[model samples]
Target: MLDLFTIFSKGGIVLWYFQSTSQIFTPSVNALIRSVILQERTGNHSYEHDSLRLQYKLDNEFELIFVVAYQKILQLSYVDKFLNDIHLEFRDRFKNELQSSQWFSDYTFKKSYDNILVAAENWGKAQAKLPKQMRTFDESFKSKKTVASMIERKDDKDNKKQEGKCLFTLVGKKKKGTNGTDDDLISSQEVLQVEAPKPVQNVNGDVFEDPLMMNRIKLAQKFSGQKKKADKQKSPKPEKAGKKPRVWELGGTNKDLATLERTKDKPEDEGDYIGADTTLIGKMKGGIQDLEVESDSVEESDEVEEIVEVNKSPVQKKSGGMLSMFKSLVGNKSLKHEDMLPVLDKLKDHLIAKNVASDIATKLCDSVATKLEGKILGTFESVANTVKATLTEALVQILSPKRRVDILRDAFEAKKHGRPYVMAFCGVNGVGKSTNLAKICFWLIENNFRVLIAACDTFRAGAVEQLRTHMRHLNALHPAEKHDNQTMVQLYEKGYGKDAAGIAMEAIRFAKESRFDIVLVDTAGRMQDNEPLMRALTKLIRVNEPDLVLFVGEALVGNEAVDQLVKFNQALADYSSSNDPHIIDGIVLTKFDTIDDKVGAAISMTYITGQPIVFVGTGQTYTDLKSLNAKAVVHALMK
Candidate 1:
């Protein structure tokens, strides 16, 4: 049974509603609108919020919405037919008022709604009563097969050749064949006589001259010779040498003890840390706001304008890039499933070519087809532009961030409260987790914020040294002399092979006590499938509770990357051992410059996690870190 049914205008006005329960559904409905409809995920057939399952339909021409809500456990079938029937009935009954801009007037549709609901329920019951039918012979694969294809032929010539070879010395008689050919037939008594011969001594005076014995001896000798050769080819092992400790050239000494002493922490001096300078802050902001992405060559044409124009169509453009090709199929009438299949298929291919996941592209095309069904296109309007516009809008909505992460502003807020802003970087091995972490740290320090890099990546060799080198370079760029004898950046590391969670916790504590502006935790790069490593990552995030947990991923990934993101998010949620587990907060897309226009990874990551991409790593330098610009990314994708 349906729990709620509603009809409303696109402008937030509830035209009419019916409910069987007193439960409040505003929150659930609003969630559907925000997360699915507003996010351009209309290709999805149903949405589950709390215990309710909601299905919605959009009336593009009339600017109306029809939604049916029911309990999640119920397997409802009539709701779709019921919604369709009611939509047509209500539109036909009130077409004049709908077109006259009289939306605020009262609608008396109770009788008509009940009749349509009952008819739909009856139709569903009838379908259930029918028995399952068997498929016809023509529908089976056997019906399409041929007998000739199933037969296997043997080669008589090869068989005869194999039989003609003599195996041993035997007495045989040649008989005259019918075709004047010779046929040899062996005699059993003669074969036994030949086999009864005695063995003879060889020239080496070592064993016997029997053919079987000689062959066995030769095989044994060959194996022994090969074994000796293998032994001779083996390389000698080198002697182990003593290990030496790594030395950093920037390591402090007794001569700099005075300068280091002034940088020491005091309880009451926590609030005295200097904030980021204005010039550096502006530079950081400009980098993010003005991020440049290379679009496709097709972008130079008027395609972008066409896409934008189609989006403004009366029905919100329920079309994709191929709508123009199939415009003749839906001329002067409502679109059916058959009419839209070719167009949707073409759109799906287009999206896949644009680097979208195959499954995701199919779903997006289904959604566009759903939005376009039962809508009539104008007689004189260009269908191609309309289709392009709708697909472009959906792509743009998907790329748009649901929530913004203003790191600079938030860091200052944390500074004012006399605490350190903590951020942890986690991802698979060699996705540039440490490299991007360094880039972000550079950006933070550039804004005059003192930063601490926590090297908790104790698993990989040289992880600590790599971070130390970056710390040294960053400090050199902003030396103590330029910052009133105060070091701009510091490294907190406990060598290698320690507890990463414990290290992160200690680092955060030290940063707070040292009055540092930000603490960037560099975790070990681990595969999503590694349970031990994933647990350690979960422990780090759960215990330290960093302000941001960024999942660093390579943009040069495809369908496999989807699995990686899903597994990482699932591991974080499953292993947190808490009712309110914290998963990935945002994404840090690495090697963005390498993938020219294959920006599907960005969409896939954001769609799976519903988290915004906070930082994009375009180049190898620290200055290459920038914020994601949704429009630029969409432009590149469409191109």
Candidate 2:
């Protein structure tokens, strides 16, 4: 029996639903919508959340979703057939209402759903009862056998005819020999022994062997001797050097260590991020600055429109174009998979060229093909134009964030409750996790928010000192006298070789006690494949429970971007040992300025984790951080 069946609009309005049990399945269904549907992973056949496996089909023409959920342990073969039957039935019955946008109206689909489900179950049973087909001659391996192999050879036939025959008869049935005893007869065989012939010698007393063969033997001996000599003359391997611990440029001595040490009870002085006379002071009004990813001119959209119109014009022709496959497709005819294969292949290649992961590109193209497979084209619309437009829309929709990640507003809300907001930055090694953390810290302090930098990256040798250096630089920029002798930024570090999770917990406590507005925990940069380090990261996030968990990744990556994000998320979910795990909440894409037009990493990252890119690091300075613009990224990708 099905646990639940539902039909909903793409906009998330439930049109009709039936439940066989009283158990609430809202969370499971919503997870499917968010992780699979919204993430453009509909190419997958089923989505498993908790113990319920949800299978769904999309109604592209009507913008509807039909879903059926059941226990994962059950092998319900009829679910797919039932979903299809009910989808067609419901769509046919409500065609008029759906065409008129009456999706919100109450739908009485229980009777039709039951009839379809029963028929599907019966069909499945009938299929199970039928005998499995036997393999035909062509399907069997015998069909591959050659006639020559099946026939017996003449030599084999002679060997078989000679079987059970002896070279000598039993010698007249054992003739008697000496002493009147039965004796064996002499064998009918002859034996002859000969000595080896002596080598022939010439007058010079040289053997008559081939002169060239003798010469070759002598040369081989000479070469082998030379090789042995060369082996003995080889030099000895060098000894390895001892490893030296890294020394930071700003390394502190014993005397300076006292000043660097921080205590939780120490009171902080109040100050803003910038000084009154500072040049950047005027630009600090906004809580967080937005990224200027898109062009300032509005004419770019007009140019895009013109290009699209040109593509749609019949006068323009492409050799072996996408429309060639659809030339036989007449007006008001439904599109088929074969009709869209050529265009999908081209689009897939286009996406891959833009640095999108090959798997993601293929899936995206498959999803687009699925969407357009049954839709009809207009009278003047070419298949190429339709596909291009649909692909553009899909790209835009994918890049757009489903939910806003406003750190400044959340910080103010945490301040109102007199608690510090915590944000943890995590990612693979060398992806600039700490650098971007400092950038975010700068932004937070610029908005007059008291910020505490937590150095939880105890694994990296110079991580704490790096944060310390950034803290010093930011403090110099915003001195205590800038706002009534208050210090705008401070660092809380317990040195290296400490438990990062413990340090984060202590830092959050210290921030709260010290009345800081936010605590930015800079975690160690570790590769996602490092199990021990990944487990440590999971423990840190699980223990600290930061207000937001940001995965810092480099935009310069191509296929590796998918592996990093996927393994990171998988580690969090698998190692947390909780029903509700603390996975990555958002992404911080660094090195955005480096990748000029290959912005597919943004799409790949978002698609894999279903998280928005909250911060983009465009340069080395703290002010280089900016928010991600979906449209701008989509434009760059399409170009």
Which lDDT tens digits does candidate 1 get at residues 389-474? 67778877877788888888999999999999999999998999989888888777778889999999998999998887777667
TM-score of 2: 0.71
Model 2 lDDT per residue over 1-639, tens place? 899999898898887898999989999998998877766677876999888999999887778899899999999888888988888888886696767867533345666777888999999999888899999999999889999888999998898876533322222244567877765343234222212223568899996654544454445445334231221366887898899999999988899978888653232474223222245443544655565554232221211111224556634233343234323323676767886777678778877887899998988887777677678776666565677677778877787888988888898999999999999999988999989888887777778888899998988888887887788767766777876777778899999899999999999998899888999999888888999999999999988889999999999888999999899999999999788999999999999988777788988988888788898899987778888878777777765
Clashing pairs in 1: 43-367, 276-447
CA-lDDT, candidates in order: 0.77, 0.78
Model 2: worst 10 consecutive residues (lDDT sum): 299-308
Deviation in Å, model 1, residue 433 alpha carbon: 0.7
Per TM-score, the best of the predicted structures is: 1
Misplaced by over 4 Å in model 2 are 6-18, 25-35, 90-115, 126-284, 287-289, 292-330
